[model samples]
Target: MKEANITDRQKKENAIEKIGEFHRFGSILGLERMNELMKRLGNPEKELKCIHVAGTNGKGSVCRFIYSALLANGYSVGIYTSPYLTVFNERIELDGEYISDSDLAAYTDEVLEKVSQMTEEGFASPTEFEVITAIAFLYFARKGCDYAVMEVGLGGRGDSTNIIEKPLACVITSISYDHTDRLGNTLAEIAREKAGIIKPGAPVIMNVDTDEAKREIA
Candidate 1:
């Protein structure tokens, strides 16, 4: 299958190789493989309450808000975001702290063992986003986080984070002009897509975006 571009950083002959392999087979937006992978990991997401945030922009900000609020409320919060502001490991946090270099290294090994087996068994390796997502899940689970805030890596409808069957709530940051090639145009259309997060009457918060966007939310 055709693949997305691989980052130059993956050229390294180390743990990131698994990350690269993941990108190779990670195409076609769906929850089957992700659900399977999460199950193999024993559904760490089940024991955790999560705030899943998604939108074109301001997603990270929304997650930051939820994470901080959860922390201030005396809850241990773990956060995971996409396209880190700078460093890759910055994407994963444990109780308001970034995952340590040593922990990232160790976790990469654990991630690789599972990811490799998945690939060998004819499962897609997962995308860069998916692999990191898995690592984030494992970290949060192992670290005993009370809640984890996850920002969708792409459209909410088929995002890897959707593998989490339950969440404290779903938050759509702002629906605007971005990723149109995948999400479609018109606020209503995009809203329909973002609305995928609504889990059968689950509580949702959409405090950003246009009136049309809000209409879509309604």
Candidate 2:
């Protein structure tokens, strides 16, 4: 029997469903897969002037504060945060407006197509967060954002958001032993992962409380 045709809405739903499955797949660190995915999407992250935020807690709040300050200063800002309090659309936004549903679906479709191509070419599909990060970057680039405040979804070094090789600044909020399972148990070790968001030559605003963590971050 011939395969049934799907509508664009259906395509969008399928794409979103595929991304939803990433949670089951779990978080996978390492930049290789993220790099491959970005390459397929034309590397939108490179076009952005971003402020990277990393920490066990308060990263989301930090991102929001920076975003607000930038908007108040008349800069067009893009926001990328995770574990939204409400819907997934809250994670990617611009100029204080969440990404529209149609826009989200459209971008998801495009990204999914690229993912399929990657799979065909022997590359693994990007994790859900990775895909969402790419979409945010693409959306920001397309909308001409003056700055993007990006909150690291996981530990900094291998986090998907770390793909931005050159950020305007790196801000490390209060580092703690919250993600001991993924980022290590000690303050120093957690500080190291949080510090991974630091790009060489990029100024860092660190607010580490623990002396060991502060020293390690410094």
Model 1 lDDT, residue 187, Cα = 76
Candidate 1 lDDT over 119-165, as tens digits, reads 79998657777777888898899888888998988888888888777
Error of 1 at 65 (Å): 1.6
Candidate 2 per-residue C-alpha lDDT over 18-111 given as tens digits, one digit per residue, 9 for 90 to 100 = 6897666578888888899889899989999999999887898989999999999999999999888876778899997988766788888787
Model 1 weakest 10-residue run by lDDT: 1-10
TM-score of each: 0.85, 0.92
Candidate No. with top TM-score: 2
* Model 1, runs deviating above 4 Å: 1-13, 25-27, 208-212
Q: Count the clashes in each prediction.
A: 1, 0
Q: Tell me, what's the RMSD of every candidate?
A: 6.7, 4.5
